[model samples]
Target: MQAAISFAISLVAMSFGIAKLPLGPWERGFLALGLIFVVTSSFTLAKCVRDRQEVTEVSSRVDKARLDKLLAEHDPFETKNL
Candidate 1:
């Protein structure tokens, strides 16, 4: 969600900056906002990819038999005391 917002902000800012090139306001604010959004989205995407990779790596190392055994021990319908 944040990545999407950042991308949108970046696009808007970049557009503003481009539009201002002809009007002569320089659009410094929009340009800076665009840069910030791009950086933030890049970092967010990198972190998400890293997390997904870690999860995939861990899942690949799991022992199916042990997992089944653990699941078999649980009673899904039973209520437990906290």
Candidate 2:
């Protein structure tokens, strides 16, 4: 969702550069904002991919059945001896 917004803003600003075919204050501002949006979005995308890879790596090291048993033992409905 954030990536989409950033891309859209960047595209709109770039359109001004292409349509006007002249460099001016507003056009320059738009160009700068567009570049910022692209860079920020790219960084965000890279972070998301990196985090996902880390999670995949960690999950692969765990034993699924043991994990499930631990989850079941911690159930809120389970009675505990005080």
TM-score result, candidate 1: 0.47
Report the C-alpha lDDT of model 1 over 1-82, residue by residue, as the tens digit. Answer: 9978986886787776666675444565566666778778988999999999999888866766678889999889999889
RMSD of each: 9.4, 8.1
Best by TM-score: 2
**What is the lDDT of every predicted structure here?**
0.77, 0.78
lDDT string, candidate 2, 1-82, tens digits: 9978986887677666556766777877777777768778988999999999999877876767677888887878868799
Steric clash pairs (candidate 2): none
Q: Please tell me which predicted candidate would have the highest lDDT against the true structure.
A: 2
Question: Candidate 1: what lDDT?
Answer: 0.77
Error of 1 at 23 (Å): 8.2
